[model samples]
Target: MENSRRSSLKLFFFVIIFILLAPQALSESDECAAEANNSCNNKARALKLKIIAIVSILMTSMIGVCLPLVTQSVPALSPERSLFVIVKAFASGIILATGFMHVLPDSFDMLSSACLKDNPWHKFPFTGFVAMLSAIVTLAIDSMATSLYAKKQSPGTSGHVVPEGDREMGVEVVSGGENNNFQFHGHHHGSVAVGKDDGSKLLRKRVIAMVLELGIIVHSVVIGLGLGASNNTCTIKGLVAALCFHQMFEGMGLGGCILQAEYKLVKKVVMAFFFSVTTPFGIALGIALSTTYRENSPRALITVGLLNASSAGLLIYMALVDLLAADFMGSKMQGSIKLQIKSLAAVLLGAGGMSLMAKWA
Candidate 1:
């Protein structure tokens, strides 16, 4: 176990080092002009649009994220319901497409921009390489964190994590001492069985919430900065609307995970607050840095591209393995064919809707 833990840490560090240095290896100096001016370059109008975007995005994000949390008050939205399963599947699909169709492509575009160094940046695929490495690193963190948290929860207690086979076969095994195993069948006095099932699962959900939020925030800030620094009133007007919708959908995805974590009210409020303000804060920062910051500059392209790639990898992995796979393979979906079909349709709709938004965003 010690060897395995050490190996995981080593692999994690290696990936981090590679991610940091990959840009250097791929760096080249290629000068290209910034985007051509198409919109009225009025400082006062641009400032007004930025302020409007900041307010609009903040409100929409709060509404989208808070929607899921508030739904917990309604019995119909309970986690056990088929409707809940379908809704979550749809949210997961939105997250998946955001990673693949939105962020990953953005990273590719930035890294492959003509403003960057040509010899390495143009010759090699740094975006995919970083994204691939980022995915591996994310998986390592997920597994290791889960194992560590589980161990902490059961400190010095020696017992198997009730086998999956036993759980599925309607048997709940409670081990208190060596050779002392109690098996309970069905829901007869189900308190112990339910506790055993929920214990470890809760920890996993909390981790997913925290990591998913980080990934989403990275993308949010990058896009916000791009929008905030723009002098194009025409472009900003359209983008403000598109971005409001973008944050709303993305918030719904993050909000679903946060809701599942079953956090205390204070923690939920804090998370929601942070998600809602991140874009606005990014915009504010961009406004402050607009004079010196250029999005198409070599440094900007490399930094944002790498960050986007890393976020893409993290989001994709969490949506696929943690959110989508866990639910799709769980007992709820497995027991109902109709629910599965409905859930699949929801997934496609969610994905399609997000993909369509990407065209403008």
Candidate 2:
């Protein structure tokens, strides 16, 4: 009986030892996890400073972008004013810089980051490929949208009128009236006169403005998210100043486009609001997800990098092909080489200024 009791006591002692040691082991593991979580939380706190900086940047951006749109009420800033053309040229240059220097390079950096795998990302120029495709896609959208709008406006095969000869005479009279209207008021009106020629142009400008805004917003939000999610104080401090200037200049470009669109007051406000809020919203979202969000993580990098690449392509295409090319090649510019040279200088100035900002941003 005593021997049996001793055996039982030994078994109980072993059980007690295991039970105590098990908890201690688990507690140590829990402590390690807690330490890791605390480190993450500290990182998140640092990111909040970036969020604050971005908020300030966005506010200034909003003011800059909305300034031109709201300034239309001033006669000096109206579309017909000569200064308007110069301002537009400058804005276009800024946009050009944004695409080439800011967005495209950032895309290349992200897609080609050393942190990413080598097999596919390093093997291919994904940034350029994506950008090229995006440009092509934007062109398709631009042309198709303009064509669709034209078709809708045109009186089609469902002919309801037989006044063929009078129609030609009426069109001539309307065209003369439109010329007079342009000379006197700097605008064409009357349904027939406005509808035939200026309508399509107006529609095209509106489409361009909206699409450009989309591209800018995508970039702005992505940048804001990066700022808001980053925990690096050194990076954040420089980014704060750089981003402020970045948003201001980019905003001016978008604002110029919006001013040309001639949208209603409500629509103008809405567009300006959208442009202003995108970055702020991104920052807010970043802060909310800071716990789980990793800016350099594989998934986040790929998604944001692709988006930035696409936006850069669209902006570059629009700024070069649509805005700058059209203006430089148009009769207004061709009429005077001096004016063209002046505009070109303005463009270069704007582009140079924006490019300088990229160094810090």
Candidate 3:
């Protein structure tokens, strides 16, 4: 158990060490220091901007995450509507673009940075290697968790009870939604109570939701930390804008997952709070460490690089395999040709928007 916990958590030590050991690497020449001093002429303005950034990002993140949760209060927004599937597809695209356009490229840049040793860094693609390994690791954990959950679930609790209306119609309405399409192989029989086995599917959604949040948290912290530690006000403005949008859309995607997880009220609130505050919290941590945190150091580069790679892999896999593929290839999507076309367009729009934002970041 101890070993397993350590294995699961070993990656976090990279960020911790990056934060703590960064001071020792402050060996930049006088020229570099001189440039930084020249550029940071308006400390007062930068401080105010950073403060605004914190408040702005926090509010936006809260709004984005809570937006989806608020739907539960409204009785009209059923998942059976095409709007729900389209929204989910759009959010999934944003997540996919974040991994491919933002995190993966950042990894490549940091790992292949000019500051690193060319002998190994240039000779091999460590970013790709680490990302691939992380993706495989995530898959292993996903499969293992599913099996374990399946075993522990009692037979009495093996499925959800069909609603009276659904029973009369010989169908389970709740299970037909794109987000709730937990059936395997995209197979569904019309007028059949497929959601009778929703207990196991709910377990799977819970696992995927938690896992998705894990990846998002790691990536958000890294981005926030770098932004907080930056001394350049000119670039900070653009990064802040990009990140605000980034966190908002990512929150929406995560919020959708939380909705599907069907947690208790307290659990739902707790999860939403964490997601809302993660990037801002990372920014605060970075602000506290700014004096000692040298973003360009070799050690910092390697650690952030590997961390980003791992995050990229996890996000990419979850976005594509668990979220996108599960929903797109599900019976819900397959049953509606018009919905599929609309959803594909939504995916492209979301991905395209995120990709455009990457240019600014």
Candidate 4:
């Protein structure tokens, strides 16, 4: 089941990448026509800064992502502890602010740019529309994936072997006959009892981790491209600082999810590598196509704007519904009022930090 989900996710990413790049490919021949005035005084200085940025951002991203993974051995950061919950809450907040404060506004700006024809651009709220549709699509995919996983885990349902949940639940049922059915009756007594099932929760976490990476990478590539194709030294300087912090904070969010997924050592390394390199990869692509890539061109604006809107929707839904809501309403938070307050504060801090960074980025 997990294998199938991963395959589908890969295909989904490929499709999105194609959609984003198709316009760039078509507009290459006419890039000079759509090019905005270059305001930078020193091309050499800008190139130096871009090189510095590439290295700095890459290192920061690696450190941020690997931090959580390496610290998983710490007792305080254990998955069941209160600290983990609080930290995850903060990460969720970062992701939430990323969608609302960063990507969404960028989409609005690009879509509303004066460079594009005023007719359709001003005729309707395409940013909001695309974002809304993306949210709905994310919800549908989330729920369907969960349902499918559960079904696949069922015994004798599809000729696939039953996983741990079914076998454990079955054992309890048969063992009940020998006893006075107390164990079986007690199992379903609480509202959140069923959610404690290890297999189901693990499955959910893995799904969330994979999906969150997809949403994040979409924006990461876009931002990289934006920075890479720009020749303005003044703009690139501020962008370098902003994106470094941006990638670091976003890395923490993704790292938290990856930790919760309980991936194997090899899988963890692979995921971390992917997250760390994506933006740099985008920067590289941007540099290679710098001459032919017009950032303000109509084709570039529309394609990137739509992709941002879609990614914003996906990230917002996943952060709010899957990450925040799920954990807040889970057994752990529900059992403690004080802890919930701390977690909420952590969330605000994370969101506030990201929101501040948005001003420059």
TM-score of each: 0.82, 0.76, 0.81, 0.84
Best by lDDT: 4
Q: How do the candidates rank by lDDT, highest first?
A: 4, 1, 3, 2
Each candidate: what lDDT? 0.76, 0.70, 0.75, 0.78
Worst 10 residues of 2 by lDDT: 26-35
**lDDT for position 357 in model 2:** 85
**In candidate 4, what residue range of length 10 has the lowest lDDT sum?**
174-183
Q: Looking at candidate 2, what is the lDDT of residue 43?
A: 66
- The Cα RMSD of model 4 versus the native structure comes to 5.4
Clashing pairs in 1: 28-117, 29-117
Superposition error at 265 for model 4 (Å): 2.2
lDDT of 2 by residue, 1-361 (tens): 3322433354345435423432222212112111123333456557667657757976888888987877889999887776777778888998999999989999999899875788799999999999999999999989997776556534542311112122323332223432421111223253333233454566677778777877787787777777666666666677788777777777877888877766655566666777777777667666656555665665666777888899899999999988899778877788888878888988999899889988788
Model 3 agreement with the true structure over 227-272: per-residue lDDT tens digits:
7777678867898899889888888888888787766555567667
Off by over 4 Å in 2: 1-48, 153-192
| Residue 148 in candidate 1, Cα distance off native in Å | 1.4
Where is model 1 more than 4 Å wrong at Cα?
A: 1-32, 159-175, 178-195
Q: Itemize residue pairs with steric clashes in candidate 3.
A: none
lDDT value, residue 245 of candidate 1: 77
List the lowest-lDDT window of 10 residues for candidate 1: 22-31
